[model samples]
Target: MVLRRIFPAMYTAKDSEPANSKNGTLYLLRCVFFMGVRKPPKRYFLAYCLWSFALNLCSTFYQPIGFMTGYVIHLSEFSPGEFLTSLQVAFNAWSCSTKVLIVWYLVNRFDDANEILDEMDKRITQDSERKRIHEACSLSNRIFFFFMSVYMMYATNTFLSAIFIGRPPYQNYYPFLDWRSSKWHLALQAGLEYFAMCGACFQDVCVDCYPVNYILVLRAHMQIFAERLRQLGSDPHESEEERYEKLVQCIQDHKTILRFCDSLRPVISGTIFVQFLVVGLVLGFTLINIVMFANLGSAIAALSFMSAVLLETTPFCILCNYLTEDCNQLADALFESNWIDYSKRYKNALRHFLHNLQQPITFMAMNVFTISVGTNISVTKFSFSVFTLVKQMNIAEKLSKTEEEVENLY
Candidate 1:
């Protein structure tokens, strides 16, 4: 519902036929602009970049950092169960903070990516292709957000529990304010944390959605681009000269697509690497919570939280997997083209193009590993391994402590 203005889940035929798809992009940018996540307009003669930094901290990076300040500092004092909670929160903090830091430092690269996307959008001349891209983007948004909303339901538990239990979400240290001194102070603090939570979730969603959404749009463009490749020299009405011109245009568009990929490499590589690094531990802790927590609410939270994490992280791999496949399909597409009778120049260009596509266009995570669905399985296996080790250690500790108690009694 929140993103309906930008990308409607259910739109009629006429509704999809806008003057341009740039409106949705504009609407999203306006929302992110107000949040100070996106770079401010150049028209603002003296815009302070610090506002974006401040907003990033408050919106996404602060709460977990705040919670950890108390729990993490005195880590040796907490029991295993207590420490697990802190660890879970810490892993999450690392993920969110790293992404926030990336945004703060790399906002301009992000702007480049967005502008390139709009340029790519303008290249889609056919109404049918535009509608197809529109529907694909809309479907991607709906699926992404539906899981996100479910996870938000899980996150809402923190706020709900705060309201019912009359305590803030975290028992973290706040050096600036004595928020726990009185009911009013506590109430005010809770209100602020709630505000922070809403803002943080929204910004984090946008941060993630930006690159992924742009890439998804690029992927859609390539899908059309591939079909266009297959249609080369098919129109006999056009002379050989005309068909050759069309091939040149196709090659130019392909280069634009490649430039888009080059721009996106910087935008996604580091983000994906850090995200992959955390998934193992985060999933391990949450899986442990589901297995160990006797409380129904805690178990549900753990389960839902695990589901949300998977929803949030896994689809990137899945999407990249599909995108990789789409890119490879271009080779076959060009080969299948009716270029048998085309000019020598067209065949030479097509041959070079097919050769480039021959080496499958796979994106890597920080140049470390290929982003694909296989990574998802590997992550899951690593998480289960961590869960097993942690589980056995916890059980062994309980048994050893029990024996010590018996010995003392004896």
Candidate 2:
């Protein structure tokens, strides 16, 4: 399949292999989905735009209609469960807008994604430790794809439940405000909305996975560079001049890796920031909905959906942490090398490299929040706080209603 050829692995097959032979199923999916092409064809570009437009339109309207119906018109006053549902609906609508923004960012900055892939391809093909790095990257890609597949299954199941079981055939949760009540009309509306959600989810996975691949490749390069640094003066057959040359080459590689990290920031930082920001709210609302209606079938399905959302948002933090740790290890690796045995000039070069490594290569979210394990911790804490607050409010509202009923009895 063309998709399989386009979507699977970052590294191309060895030149000795037949071009036709390289088009394996797994490889093509990896290429098409995550490892985007340098120049996407016109049709692909148009499809991307159409998908983005649909998502944007749906998300853009979803929130306003939810607010008007839930708050302004007080439609959710009938029950606490309905109120919780309203809040979750509003939050999901808002979060979808963020997805649209991320999709837009990914489409606009696709060239940067292609460049990262190209750099990875070069390193995997040319590096002496290609086999090790290739294996590591392949492992990471598999883990990523496995997570995505699980999320997709969960999402599909949730959507199907929402369509068949959660709502009447001639109605949906979509705030279409005014429309014909025909079953076919409702089905068509629900189908378009479902299609938009699926498309956005797929795009979201692709955009997020691109950064994962880049970070993995970057970590691989750093590992290889660290090994070279460690082996700098250990080769007995190499002369002083040869050792110095190798040291210079290692310095150059370090700089290239750093430059690549810089190039990656602009492509992903804003999208990651938005993702982190929204995940907290989404999680909070989902939790509130689950607690309010624990036995409700719709709530159970929504819980599954939100679990998938969390899984999707988590890799940004994990991969960023990995990159930071890998970059920091460069200094330690260099320090542990046989640098003391080298000439003064070579020692000076080591000093320069160590100085560079002092500032660890860290990814930022929107140039403000650093993406790390700590950020993940902070987001979790924030989500918990929001959930607690919403839970308390619900409790208080219930208590107030109980008191009102008691007064009427008196």
Candidate 3:
């Protein structure tokens, strides 16, 4: 009832098309056959598991860097005696959360899936002139695992070194701990933590969002195709019978596509909400802890950066919402009365819309994540790389007529 009210233009004849028997049978066969392939190499799998463990350790070990740096930045001087205790607590918590996320990513392969999916999708679409998607798909796992290993090892070692030097900051905060350490260690730790946090966030984003973006593209493709079919027979002078048959066929196809989309939505939506809850809870706890123990500058910086990460992630959330809306939008377009005319050029419009939708979603989910990782993790070098990539994409995209053409065509 609510849907009907909001989409008054979207009511169409109920479609009850039989499932694609061939594709169904083939899907089952493929799954069964592929299930026989032995798991990825034990060595590689072990490496990844270790990588995840180390990442969490380093993240935990050097967690205080952000707080330290923030405090230093705000004060323009280091006061190890004041912030040591708070830094310790912050570092420990950060490490634990970072580890948990690493474990989560590894166990579920959510991040890995996104990377491979993006690579595979781009190879299929953007690189269509050269390589086959089949080849691309086969190589995705290899490339991702290689990249993951190199990244995790370097990140882990860097943080560990930072921790070794900076451990004294905590001791300094509590004179009772009775440990002596140099001020240089604290300064070094501060620098290391900032760089490390960036790495963790950037890499994690790359691994998770790319695949979701691919799925979004797939959804757009189906919607565009349905729209195309609807336009094939649109004619004002056509008899009611002819129009009815065309609409009926289009409805049937839409239902088929819609069912597939509906089946997948639960997976996408569930994962998204779970991540949101987890991130929110962790950040909330961090905030409360900071308020209770830490002073203003450190607390503000931690909170501000956390807020920035969340805000940066806003595009992804919006993309998810847009996908759901697209489905219903197509449903509404199906039932439009004036849409019966071929002269409306609905098919062409839909193709353009589908293509246009893919860009922002892809940029937010894949490109943004990659850039974020580089910037967050490698502040000295890759930070600028991420920034430059994002800046370039944004500027080039604006200057280009692709979006404008698509909108006008649609």
Candidate 4:
């Protein structure tokens, strides 16, 4: 009886092995080749561009509506009055449009450059490993473009629409639709912002980690070239001059890799600077403006949560800059480390790191904000679960200070 009960499990495993083994190997091979699987097709590229353009067009049309509506409404309604309200509306529209344009243009340029790099790298036929690197670069660029395009477009569109469309902003004036504390609107806002957070986190992961992987590949190439040089020198028939020439060529390739590292520095630094400055100014201004009219406590809670997110993300952005700089310096020193017998091990370690690269750090980061959805909150007081969660954890003190400074401005 026991054997009969166990028979199905045994047979299931027996029957599954051939198919599972073949499929698993195939899947592993694809992952080994591409590092990450291929992204959606090229048609998605054109669709993304068009979607951004459409979003910009929509925002531009509605800017006038927000301005006109705020103007027609009496000045006394808003705490700062009508002129200030209209100005904030117009400014928000302009700020949002600018953000969309900036994100769109930067992401587009990175996509083009990464694709070119991948093609160039693909031509290096030392082994399957080289091909895998190129394919990974290509796939990562595609994924980055997809995430950023979706994030910037949707965020800009939602923000613009909320601020400008009809009475939402004029009535709520929440800068964002803060429905998490509102029973009627909680579910919808949660779904939307959760998507937004996912995209944002994914973009951050790609921008931060892609270069690190590429740097690892370059380091590996350096080590391999060093080995080849040693082998050439050891050969009984090889000429000293030939060995020197190979060494020179290897050094040149190393320099080329360094140049790629240098190129990424400005991209990383500029992204951090521009994103922080723009988000900081816009968010600070919006929160202060909102507090002037709405429930001050609710505004405080909402703005505090926003600042927490902005601050927590700041470290990742700064780390991107740090990695870019560190990689350049490290790439230079890695060649020198050969004398100490550390170069080979270092290179091997980097390879292992690259092998485990796509481990969902981005998805995990999004959980900071995502899982807060539908948690216990005070609907009457308009406090959010996000605020409670972060407060309990005591994150983002600098962000809290900045929020206070901005709030004081109002």
- Top lDDT hit: 1
Which lDDT tens digits does candidate 2 get at residues 1-410? 67546654544434343222112123323433432322345778877666445554554445335445446554423344445544554555455456545545555354454454455445333434665555555655665566567656655655565566433211224555332466675567556546545544554555556566556556656777777677678888888899888778777777667666676677577667776776777677667667655346656666765766666557767877777778678888888888787789988988987888867777788888888778877786676788888666777467448656856776
Q: What does the lDDT read for residue 96 in candidate 3?
A: 35
TM-score of each: 0.83, 0.76, 0.39, 0.40
What does candidate 1's lDDT look like per residue over 1-410, in tens digits?
56555555433234346424333344345546756755466876246466665666665667777767867554444444434544675576667667766765666775676666677776677777787677656655555566457656666765665456466554445665555578877777767766666666655565566555666667778888888889888887999788888878887887777777777676577777777788888888877755664146545556666776675567777788787788788888989989887678878977887887777666788888787889877876788998899777787367447556756776
Cα-based lDDT for every prediction:
0.66, 0.59, 0.39, 0.38
lDDT of 4 by residue, 121-191 (tens): 53254543343333433333343343344445434443344434222333322234545356446445434
- Give me the overall lDDT of model 1: 0.66
Instruction: Give the local distance difference test score of model 2.
Output: 0.59
What is the lDDT, from 0 to 100, of the residue 72 in candidate 3? 50
lDDT of 3 by residue, 1-410 (tens): 99656532222212232111121122222221222212344667766556545554444344445455455553323333233334433543453344334434343333333333333233222222222222222233333333334444433443444355444322222212222245565555444454545445444433333333334334434445435443544565787567556655555554444444443343344333334423444344344334443445445444543443343234345555555566555645544434434433455554454343333221221222322232223322332443355355664344234445645765
**In candidate 3, how many Å is residue 267 off?**
5.3
User: Candidate 4 at 101: error in angstroms?
Assistant: 3.1
lDDT of 3 at 137: 26
lDDT accuracy of residue 176 in candidate 1: 59
The local lDDT score (0 to 100) that residue 275 gets in candidate 3 is: 41
lDDT of 1 at 317: 79
By TM-score rank, best first, the candidates go: 1, 2, 4, 3
